[model samples]
Target: HQRLLCEIFNEICIPDLRSNINVDRILTLRRQVDALKIHRETFEKDLNELEDKHIDKKRKFLELNEKFHNEYAD
Candidate 1:
């Protein structure tokens, strides 16, 4: 009788164990999103540094060009 009751409960209620499966999938997606966010922030920081260096180089080049013209024009 006990075995029969266990079988009946499983037949009626056990197939919806999918909720746990979906929870695992949701957690995995959340972890992926966090990893992508970290990558984006790192890329942004590196890009900003490169842009700053480019601006500094441009400024130095202009200053040298102006000084050369002033000394040679006379």
Candidate 2:
């Protein structure tokens, strides 16, 4: 009777077991997606800050170059 019950359970419960496994996989993927989004936002913010700094430096350099040329042009 035990073997018969085990066979019955295997036949009846396999689908449920497979569904639970799929649910776990979906949850894990969702968490990974959220983490990736956060990483992307941080990367974008850092890139913007670097770009702003570069622009500021370029403006300063150009201004200084113009001043030097004006003061010493022969």
C-alpha TM-score for every candidate: 0.69, 0.70
**Separate clash counts for every candidate:** 0, 0
Off by over 4 Å in 2: 1-21
Candidate 1 — which pairs collide?
Answer: none
lDDT of all predictions, in order shown? 0.91, 0.90
Candidate 2 residues 12-74, lDDT tens each?
644555455667889999999999999999999999999999999999999999999999995
The C-alpha stretches of model 1 lying farther than 4 A from their native spots are 1-21
Model 1, 6-67: lDDT tens digits are 88777566556655667788999999999999999999999999999999999999999999
- 69 in model 2: Cα distance from truth in Å? 0.4
- In angstroms, the error of model 1 at 50 is 0.4
